[model samples]
Target: MTRQHVLRFYVALIAALTLGVLGVGVVGVTYLSSQTLIRNLFPAALLIAVSWYGSQRRVLVSESDIWLMGTVGYIATLVLLPFPLAVLAVAASKGLAEATLLAKKQRHSWKGVTVNAGGTILGVAVGGGVFASLNGVSYLWSHQLDSVFALPLLLVMILLYNVTNELVVVGAITLTSQENPWSVFWRLSRAALIPEISLALVGIVFAVLYHSSPIMAAFIVVPVMFSLRAFESVATLRRETVEAVLRMAEHLDFRDTSTYEHSQRLADLTRRLASALELTPEHVEEIVLASRVHDLGKIGISNEILLKQGPLSEEEGDIMRKHPVIGAEILDSYSMFKSSVSIVRHHHERWDGKGYPEGLSGDHIPLGARIIAVADSFDAMTADRPYRKGLSVDDAVERLKAGMGTQYDPKLCAIFIQILMEEGIYAPSEAVPGELHLIAGGRASGGRAS
Candidate 1:
């Protein structure tokens, strides 16, 4: 079963166990107590059961009105009897009801299984613990049946039970959902535990001061439930934004054959080079992103020229060169892409001021752009093209080193070669001529002057 299903099962089992235990405890206490104690304990147990059911419903609906109504009903019933049994009965009832509702709802909407299961488990544990503690305290205080430590011990037990429930629910959700356990734990805790625990703490402090006021304690559960809803909404939005960006990248890949693995390889190479050069994580991410989208302007190029097997004529070459400009323009139009425009536009620029478009040389080029230039060249040479076989990794490193200070920055070239060596790409039979083979090697083969 899915994580949600397992969570639901656990919540239901806890609820059932709580009710069963409470019922048996109340029955045995009634059998052993005087008539007055039995009368008092039975009503208190009923009240606790009802409260448990109401709290469970509140968890699923997550509506303040339902929770308030449930709490009010529990209080009204408890006040009418002012008996420990009545309170226990109400709490257990609420727990059972909430667990059932969660199971039913999860059956319909399985996508929210993790959230549902987590909330349900936590809700039941919290509600059950509160009910049990209140019952224990009332019996101890009213009947003088226990020591001063009894109520405090019960409270600790309740807290431990709630914590265990949270862990189990979080674990089941992670396993079933195939999500990282830590991530699931954090997310569920932020959505459920943080708010609930905050309110519970307030209630605990209030109870310590007032001496077991169930009515007052019930008031804090409302806002905690609301906080859970808010956290879930935020998490959902963040997930959607991430998915949207990935989809956009996928769409871009569909437009060009060369783009299929280009961005990924470029990103990898750029990250390696960035690390070799001792750049920080922030700088590495920027360089990697820039490398991935460096040729984004090529989207504007016609398929006719993009897929051409032979060398382009002068006019076509000129048009092809305009892609960087087109890419820069496109990036400049988006506020989010502004920083990447330089890399897209200047990746073609050489170190000696002989590159295309702006012909920016040396330090004039943006560092990110220069890094992308090296990565893009490396990837392009090693990747197979329609008219050319992919160069070996060794030859590619050799070409990168051969072009240092002429077409590429010498320092960057050194780092790039170091990265290749470190990544085991510089081994014999794997190396290729890289950018030098694509540019200089081509010119040399044709007997053309540089």
Candidate 2:
């Protein structure tokens, strides 16, 4: 199994075991008349709850996990003594989980995860220590300090702790991912404050309701902030990655043709097909990128072959087949483009295994490539070419229908035809005088015919 699958399985197993243990402990506590059973059960319950909650959230655990665990830890410390020391232990756990999850999600190296977790732990320690010191001072000056002063001070400390918790979590994750700490901090801070503010308000409500220490209620803020921040961070990363890929696609188009209007049209068509196929946004993006760079391998081919006046000879055709391979190689060099390379390499391949360098066919072909092939073929047939006048959209649709299950993927072909028909995309070919002359002139134009 893949690492992700294994991790998920392990998490599921742990959660199940924790629940089982908690169940057994509950029974034991009820049967046995010992306070020890109840005491021991609380810690186990806290551990199980925290771990299970963290596992289930996938992206971010509920803030309650940290609060409950911290509360239990603090209570343990307090009966032996007193004060809000439990909050610190809870905050530390929160920081550690945040850092670990971030590292895993970002695919950071082990060393990076270690450093990030360590940093988070350190930040929590410092923040918790400061709060503890202030709390001690407040206890000592109980008679001297007024309720108004003490309440405001508690609020300030809670706000500081919540802010610091967010920063530490984001910082550790970003550092582990090798992203700039400042950039991560700034990006998250800008987008995440609303959620933090909301959580802070909730903490205020809790403090008012309890009429106890504000610091105890302050624990609620940590999880709320962490959840919001983590979700926003992940969403932002996805959006940025998609935009970057789209920009790269635009670059590819600009390098080949002055007008990327055709690329835009193809992108629209691809999106429609994707929706019809019920593809996820991630899959749609992959398809779009693949379609955008469908002709990328042409860059490696000589201008003569790419701009050939007439039909390619047998030898020339052989050279043309290499374009897909070359394109795949170029895309494979970059990590971001890896998902798109297969589509680029195999868009020319036929469903029947009769196409290109590797004739492996049927389900073996990548679905993204299959979808692009139909779109590419339809676009190519309808677009003006050096050797022939562009076919009318109606004609292009007919040609695509004719080639279904032979040269193109049947399912994708049907989708493309449906899209074209639905959008009223088929129209009579528009002739350009220059383009006609260029095609008619053929070899005389030094292969500028196309």
TM-scores of all predicted structures: 0.43, 0.46
Candidate 2 clash pair list = 63-223, 74-86
Identify the leading candidate in terms of lDDT.
1
Cα lDDT of all candidates, in order? 0.57, 0.53
Off by over 4 Å in 2: 1-255, 386-388, 426-450
Each candidate's number of clashing pairs is: 54, 2
Q: Candidate 1 regions off by >4 Å?
A: 1-246, 428-450
TM-score of 1: 0.43
Error of 2 at 190 (Å): 28
Model 2 Cα lDDT, one tens digit per residue, 1-450: 533344345344434543443354345435644664454444434433443343334332211112112222222221111122233333345445655567669434444343333332333344344645566335423566453554555445445544564565554433223234564465445544544445444434443422355256456556545644765575566556645655655664544462266666677677776655544344566678777776667667776776667889899899989989987887787654666788888878898899886885876788778877777676666777546777888888778767877887665675566555446674324432353223222222322111
Model 1: ten consecutive residues of lowest lDDT: 60-69
Query: On residues 184-245, what C-alpha lDDT tens digit does candidate 1 reach at each position?
Result: 46544444444454434433443333245556545545543564465456445544643454
